[model samples]
Target: MDALVLFAALFVSVAVGFALGRLSRRHLQSQYPKDYALNYYKGLSYLFNEQPDSAIDAFIGSLEVNSDTLETHLALGNMLRRRGEVTKAIKIHQNLLARPGLNTRQQHESQLELARDYIKSGLLDRAEALLLELVKISSAYKQAALEHLIEIYQDENEWDNAISAASQLDGKHYRPKSGLGLKQLQAHFACEQAQEDMAQRNFSKARTHLQEALGFDSDSARASLLFARLEIHQSRFREALDHLHKIPQQDADYLIEALDMICECYEKIGEPKALQKYLRSLLAEYPSNSLVIKIAERLRWLENDYVAADFIAEQLKQRPSIRTLNRLVELHLPHSEGRAKENLQLLKQLVDRVIEEKPSYCCNKCGFTGNSLHWLCPGCKTWGSVRPIRGVAGE
Candidate 1:
């Protein structure tokens, strides 16, 4: 179907070129060169034979690219790029760029399209050179060129370059149709830098990057989580707790990411009672199976298995979950007798398998599922879209 559409578009463009050429030269009593006429008919013959590639090549040979045919050339190149024929797209756009008859705007448009073709062909260095030139000299394409530069930097993991390109995008005028805003993307880039710093044990530099991340976007949950990790690494339990506590407010969907750090922070401070109080509050407010399991374990520790079992049972009435059910069965199995105990053990094993097989995270935008969270969705490339899976099979 798509091949047919391309063929039709190419046929129309060639026919239009023929008509324009005849109309323009009619007053001068001129005729098309024999080779041009032969190639044009050959292109039509190929189209009739459903040989699209050959047809397109023949059409290219037949058409005399000029101001009248520039737009048609661009549209054809764009369609080729969309069809994954990057090499052919590059040839067309490069031909346009090489033409001396094109005005400044046409040249800029051709450069942008050729840069895109380079990027699509995995020729980033070439694309970067052209895009950088456009970004500097062409006001009309600066924003678009910077966006492509950012994409290149991101793919290469050059966080600083990505940050610089993102900063150049006008926040007021450049609202993307999807994904994070510029500031949020900058924040994630900073967080990525901070993560690298922390991995190298450069806590001071990591802290600086985390601060810069927060300055870019104060509501960055990933930054908060990174800050908590930094503080916890340095044994600053109170500071870590402060950052971990900010995550739920920034984005409740990421609260699960902070839970383990929050627990460790409380334990490092020797405040088991405070941890229980906090877990209880989280249960009341967030109401997730993870929080439920945490509170249940605390209850079992502070009181007994019966108390934990009752709490899980009560919570399951409101939010049915396989994980919570598995925990509930575990809590009750030890005290059961004979046949009942055997049945409870079997039930627990079955529920455990079910929980283990379920995905822990899901992308809200594209429905990608995995056992671990991804800040950038693998399926859609949308930042912060993959989060903890919610409801019956998960948290």
Candidate 2:
């Protein structure tokens, strides 16, 4: 839908350009207006025929460089950029920026276009300098420049600079419902700092950064999970449990993330019974297939294979899963030998293969899936969107 709208807008702009060119060249003698209109039709024909690169060249050639046609030039250059002709776009935009009679706003707009062309051409330093200038100009486009600066900083992994740029943007000037904004961006910066601390084994420092992340946005589930993991590593089981519990309140979709970790903390503190009780209560409420399988593992350890088998069978009837089936097969493997046991072992191997192929975490924002958690999404550079995948082949 978005693509269709953008294409429609581009088509309308080309139509407007054609009209302007025809009307302006009407004052010229004889074959001039006829040639211009013919070229315009040819460009439109090429664009509609999907020869967009050739069409761009035709359109650029058809537009004459007068004050009346400067807007059309700018539009054509932007279209070239959109079409991925960065060199052509840069040449056109740079030419406009060098023009002497351009007004202050027109010059700034051209500068912005030139910066965007540099970005598309992977000229990061030039783009960054131009964007910083745009930021100081305090136009409505300042927000856009700030956004581009954030993008540049993220590409460079300059978390502190990214946070500063994100903070400088006026959030109210943007579309209200978009998730990417000041608070989310700031929390991401803190999360990145927390990850660096975690890498250095500075658990206390990591905890402090995570606390700041939560202070920036209490609904940051990634921060909560990080804090919980840090506490667990420090043997503060009770504190870890508190942090784990906060995920449900922050985002119910992430409740499963804390379950296995919280259970591990429970066992480490010598309270398996409490963990069992909590699992039963969680099953009564959320009733996830992963939680069910985990609870069945606990049952097998406490009771026997029979009890675990029965529990898994009951849960599979309610929520069918390949993981539950594989677990059930393993329970029956111990009592049997010969061909039956060999076949069961093969089936387990197949299940293991499937599970191993599946990504452990996925980014909700960008659909980037991977084996490990990333506080910042590698694909879209958004924070706290990558979450543990839960189902048959996941946590």
Candidate 3:
């Protein structure tokens, strides 16, 4: 943030100085206005000291509205917005817009700056109105205004508007709409729309949106997960199995997330034998501890405690884990007589206490760790960056 303020101050100074120099191109004023020059120096002093808010006030107070100074005010407003001083930025821009000497181009620039100020101040509706006008004008500001319109719509959950603005920026009407940088983002928006449909119990609409999401980005794990949920809702467990299986192929790192739901689908369809075979293949390939613990559970339930305990114990020798060790102790507890049972219980309690403090998921983007999965990392707002932890104490 401090860096941003410094850059903003530098940009404002350069832009103002250039615009005023252009105005003096003909008349060539020999001396600077004493008051204005002194205030400009004060601004430089404050900004250099890392007091950018004070610098913005000094610079803004020094400038007057005129054909020569329109760019200067715009630059000051932009700098204030960058410094996170939205109210002062708005006041400066609004006052500039109200002035009489600005040309059509200068007026549009002022509106654009004010729109950005509203955006910074969380006044989305005001920003939206100004940006829409700029878009309709189709001036040099059209591209920038349309981009901000998309941002406003995204924040307001207006997917249809976002898609429209994104398409325009993508050159869909003019060309193929391929190079605007939002194909993957559009997929997430479609997924968001699918989620909204699912919440309203509109399964058919949800399916349509999910299909659209996949069309936008075939590698979207959230789309696959939501599709699985939709299938599960309609009791199409076998169909759900197909979608859940695709997630690992799309992004292998997210395979751990699909495991539990995959198990449920097979269980729902009365395919425990087939499920075990599938899990075995996955475990052999991935060796994820979740899969290991899952296979041990089936062994304990279908065969005997000793078989399951021995299975986990053998796996632990190769790849030790607190989870597997805890399950191993639980399996041994049922069969052991008094003292052995007591010792196993104590060991289980200790392992439980240790595992309880471990986080389930961690973000590779920002190193944020938490106990539950987040499709969009809370720390960095990055999609698909968080995943289940994998180590001796996790998986």
Candidate 4:
């Protein structure tokens, strides 16, 4: 089916070329070029012989690019690029740009296509130069050029440039179809920069970047997480708790990422009771396997194994989970004797294997599963989409 579509598109382009040549012949008082007619037949013969490359070359040779055939040429180049023939696409678009009679729009369009070819071929530096030029001189292509520039910067890990391009693209009127608005994209970029600063132990610089990230997107969970890390690094436990507490409100899907940090902050402040209160609050609002386990561990530490086991059993009635069940068995295993003890031991081992085999995190957008959380989903590259998996077998 794809081959047929390619053939049909090529045939239409050739037909259009033939029609244009006929029209030119009538106006110029000259016979239509015999070479054009011969090449058209040669292209058809190549197509019939299953020599698509030769067919494409012959079709391109037959077409005389002018105002009339410029769009056809551009369309052919774009099709070739999409077909993974980047080198041929580059030649076609380059040939168009080299023509002297092209108007500004045509020139910009050709430059944009050639830049795309460069990007596809991994020549990002060349693509960046052409896209930057287009962003400066071509109002029609400015947004498109900036979008491509952002992609290049992201691929190159140049987050500052990505943020700058995203800022230019984030007009009041613009909204992306991915539902990941430019403001959110900019926020992620800023968070990326903050991460770099934090790695270098530049706490002040990291804080400034996190502040800018939150300014771009007040609901950025990644920014909150980073801020918590920065504050904790400085031994500002209270400040860290403040940032960690904001995560559930900013994006509850990422609340798991802040849970350990919240516990550490409360511990550092010498407030186990406060930690217990906060965990209960979170469990009441957003119950999950992790919260259940955390609360049960606290119960065991403060009271007895019986209390933790009973708590897990009651919670299991409300929300059945393998993780809670496993914990329940572990709490009771020591108290059992003979067959009962052996049975609980076997059950625990089985549940442990099952839990280990299950993925802990999953991408909400693409269903990519892994054991670790990814702020940007590896499958879809969507920011904040990957989260701790929830349900019977996960947290």
lDDT of 3 by residue, 93-150 (tens): 9888887877888889899999999999999999999999999885778888987887
Cα lDDT of model 1 by residue, 1-395, tens digit: 87778788878877887778767777853665767778989998998889977887887778767777787788888988998989888988988887788888889999999999999999999999999999899999999999999888977889999999998898877766455788898999999999999889999999999999999999999999999999988899999999998888899988888888988999899999999999888878887888888888879988999999999999999999999999998888889899999999999889888878899998888899999888777787778888888879988
For residues 1-395, what per-residue lDDT tens digits would candidate 2 score against the true structure?
54344445555776787677667667764656566666667777876677655665666556555566678778867877897878978877877776676667777878888999998888999999999998998485798888888878878878788878877878787542226567877787888889889999998889888988898888887788888889888888899888887777787667777878988999988999999998888888777767887899999999999999999999989787777788899899998899999998999999888877888889988899998777678887666678777765665
The prediction achieving the highest TM-score against the true structure is 1
- lDDT of model 4 at residue 39? 89
lDDT of 4 by residue, 233-306 (tens): 89999999988888888888788778889989999999999899999999999888888899899899989999
TM-score of 3: 0.79
User: Which is the better candidate, 2 or 3, if ranked by TM-score?
Assistant: 2
Write the candidate numbers in order of decreasing TM-score: 1, 4, 2, 3
Model 4 segments beyond 4 Å from truth? 1-5, 20-29
RMSD of 4: 2.2
Per-candidate TM equals 0.94, 0.81, 0.79, 0.92
Clashing pairs in 1: none
Candidate lDDT (C-alpha), each: 0.88, 0.79, 0.80, 0.88
What's the distance in Å from true for residue 6, model 3?
7.3
Deviation in Å, model 2, residue 183 alpha carbon: 1.1
